[model samples]
Every structure is written in C-alpha cells, then in structure tokens.
Target: MLRVLAVDDEKPLLEELLYLLRSDPRVRSAEGASDATGALRRITRALEAGPDGDDGIDVVFLDIHMAGLTGLDIARLLAGFARPPLIVFVTAHEGFAVQAFDLKAVDYVLKPVRPERLAEAVRRACAQLGRATEAPAAAAEGPPGGPPGAVPAVPGPPGVPAAHRPAAEVTAADRTPEQIAVELGGVTRFVAIADIAYVEAQGDYARLHTDGGSHLVRIPLSTLEERWAARGFVRIHRRHLVALARIDELRLDAGTTSVRVGSAELQVSRRHARGLRDVLMRQATG
Candidate 1:
C-alpha cells in the first residue's frame, strides 16, 4: 500500500488528484495540500518521524508551477531526507518534465490528469519503492530477475554475479506505439497513436492533432520522441513533431523547408531537416 500526497494551489485540482489516487487499490491513503508551503510542512514532519513511521507519505504527486515555493523546490529540499519519498510530478505544463526526470522523479503526469496515467504513476512509484527496500537483497541475489539491462530470466540462473556480466542493449522488445491517454469531457479517453497526423508541444504537454480533433495530453514531446521514434515520428521543429507516414510532400526553397501533412503545411527547422529526411528515407526503404 502507498501513502500519497498531492499538492496544488487550486482546491478542485487537489481534490481531484486525491480522488484519482485513492481509486487505486495500491494507494492506501491520499491527502492534499493547497500550496507548497503546506506540503513542505507535512513532508518535513513526516521525514522527521522517519520514512517508516505513521506520518510518512510514501509518494508525493506534486504540481510544478505554484505560488511561493514550486514543486521542484520541495523536491530539492526533500533530497536531504534519509529516506526521501518518491516524487511524481503533476502539472498543467510539460516544460518541467525534463527537469523533473533529472531529479529521478517516479513519473510526470500532465493535467487534466487521466486516471490511467495517475494509476500508472502509482504503479511505477510502488515498483521503485519496492526496489529501494529490496536493494540489499538484490545485491546479494544478483538483481531481482537477471543482470542489469538484460532480458530477465524466469528465475535468473544461480551464482552469476551481476558485476561480472556485460551490460546488454536495452530493447523495447515486442513493444508497439499505440494509444495515448487524454482528458475528454471530464473523463479519460485514449487516442490511437496511428490516427495522429502531427503533435504540437505545449510546455509540459503535447496537443495531438488528428483528423477527428486535437487532444491535449500531459506527455512531453521529448518523451514521445523517444517512444515513437522507432514508429515513424520525427521532430520537424522545436514545437512540432511529425509522423513520417503523414507527410505527403516536402518542399525546399532557399534553405527553408516545409512538409505537407494532409492539408496542413508545417515548416521544418534546418537542424532537424536532415534527421527527418533520413528517417523518411529509411521508412521508405523498409
């Protein structure tokens, strides 16, 4: 079971975050703070009691942009704790995702928060916490299932020290870029990744442009770029990433280039142009 804390300046969003967190069986309890100050107090007091104590919250779902001290500020301060709680950032923007990831955040969820996304973050946090507690055991056991960065064995063969083994390539084996979760009419909806014609980056989130309509999601463009790169998506501009399959034509004149995706015309920045062309060529060849 996980104890969660949600901090947001807005009452409604705080309440909503707590509600969503509580819906998961893994979440033992969920609480809220209207501001960073209030949250800091709760966290400091909890840390003072030790992480295993009754007051300790196991995971924090923090809002990035807020009055006074920001979520990032709290995260940095909490690093002093002997057993700092897992941090999962929740926000209306995607601009902080990169910075949050640098802090080793459990996950970053853009709002309006989808139940599935929130739940998935909780699952990740739970997994991380489990790993933290099992570290000593893992050191003696040669990792939980197998050596680092490898396809874990069913019962990982005995007595092969993890330190002696060579690190293997990380693969998303059998993975498919499928649907993304979005907020629609106060409910969480999934939009098929294949249906997206293009994606526009919005600070900490991305707006998926499709034939049906645009859906704003908390997923950062960089995150999508890494996940969907193998599936034909390429960054056309800082704010726009396009799927190669969606391009109908590429126009270049006087060092400026533009791509046609259906009826929409999007300018491609010079730095990303070569990479885009390369991906398109590879896609065509394969």
Candidate 2:
C-alpha cells in the first residue's frame, strides 16, 4: 500500500486528484495541498514523524506550473532530503517531462487528469517504493567477486540488477528499463545500465566500461548522447559520453579542463565545457 500527496494550486483540481488517487487499491491513503508551500509543510511534518507514522507520504503527485514555488523547484528541494519521497509531476503541458525526469521524477502525466493515467503513475510509484525497501536486503546478500563492503552487480550475470550505483542512475522515481543490449566477444547480452561508468566512441561503435568490465556495442555515440543525456550521460569530449555522477574529479591545469572518471582522464572541449560545469553545479547545490 502507498500513501500519496497531491499538490495543485487549484482547489478543485487538487481535490479531484486526491479523489482519483483514493479510488485506487494501491493507494492506502491520499492527501491534498493547494500549493508547493503547503505540500512542503506536510512533507516536513511527515518526515519528522518518521516513515511508520501516519503522516509519512510515499509519493508526491505535483503540479509543475503552480504559482510561487513551481513543481520543479519543489522537486529539487525534495531531492536533497535524506529519505526523499518519490515524485510524480502532473501538469497540462508536456514541455517539462525531460527536466522532471532528470530531477528523478518517476512519471510525468499531462493533465486533464485521466484516472487511468494517474493510476498507472501510482502503480509505478509502488514499484519504485518496493525497490527502495527491498534493494538493501539484496545488497546485504552481496555478490561473487564484489569488493569487501562494496555493493556490486548481481553475481554470475550482466542481466541482473547492480548495486551501489550512483544516484543519477537509480534515483529516477519510476522503474526504468533495467538492462540494455550490448555485444561483447561476439556474444550479446543485457548489461545493467547502472554498471556502466562512461562510454567511449570508436569510429561507428561505442565502448561501455562497467565497474567489472567493458563491452562494445553497435550503437552510435551521437544517438546515445541524445537518448541518455537526461539520465546523466554527457558528452564531455566529442568522442566520449561520461556519466556525470561517475566523475571523480575535474582537473584544471595548463589551460585545459579534463574530468577524471574511474582511472581514465577525458578532456572537456571548449564547446561543452560550460554545460558540464553547470551540471556539476546543479548536482552540488541540489
């Protein structure tokens, strides 16, 4: 069962959202707020009361365009919480989905508030929360060849979930696809996205370096840059798609800026320099 909080500045819309949420079997309870301000207050109170307390909310269905503090602003604030509630953005416009997903929102539902769409969102939230509660137990079980005190990829397979992944990979509010198809040594297998550190372009194909090993795939680097960019993969150089969260350090010596990810140092070109800096800044502040 899930507890959800619905926030919209419009009273009737907020009520309607709460009503729809309450109609679903997955939702154990629902609460409403007229704006982000009230939503934050309630969430704070809930967090102070603890997860087992009646006030704790498992998910938040937020309106992106509310006056004063917009949903994006609210999401960023929540992202910093020690145990942040999953966020789902509800809005009348589609323009904000990418940003919302980047902020780790589980799902984005464009408004007119269809009960079916909202229900799907609730289902996703339930799955996400389940993963959150169960993942720690999986980590406790550990894996073959994983370092001591380190959570790692599931033993005997690239097809299973990976652990201790950067927040940018697993923090998305919903259940994104767990595996991506990759070929290595003429054998194809599903690789967990969380295991990949960065991608390097080699002519037409790209190399995916995981914590355990590396694999080559037939996908173009440009396509991946656009597709996974929202998920923290950024083109630091013309030939590399580095995971922003995996970056260990940025070195600025001798007039060139380079990022150290794992053991490799990749140069950041002038064209993409500021964008990378801005990403790091947002991560720092958020």
lDDT (Cα, tens digit) per residue for candidate 1, span 183-244: 33223345578999999886655778998777665456887788788877889999998988
- Residue 129, candidate 1: Cα error in Å is 1.1
**Local distance difference test, each candidate:** 0.72, 0.72
Q: What stretches of model 2 exceed 4 Å from their correct place? A: 131-286
Clashes of each: 6, 2
- Model 2: how far is 4 from its true place, Å? 0.8
How does model 1 score by TM-score? 0.47
Instruction: Give me the overall lDDT of model 1.
Output: 0.72
Per residue, candidate 2 scores C-alpha lDDT tens digits across 1-286 of 8888899986645655776676565667888999778999998998887777878888889999988999999999988888888999999899999999999999999765555566668778878877322222322232223233332232322332221122233223113466555422112256677788899886555678888777655467787788787788899888889988899998888888999988888999989888898889899999
> Could you estimate the TM-score for every candidate?
0.47, 0.45
TM-score top scorer: 1
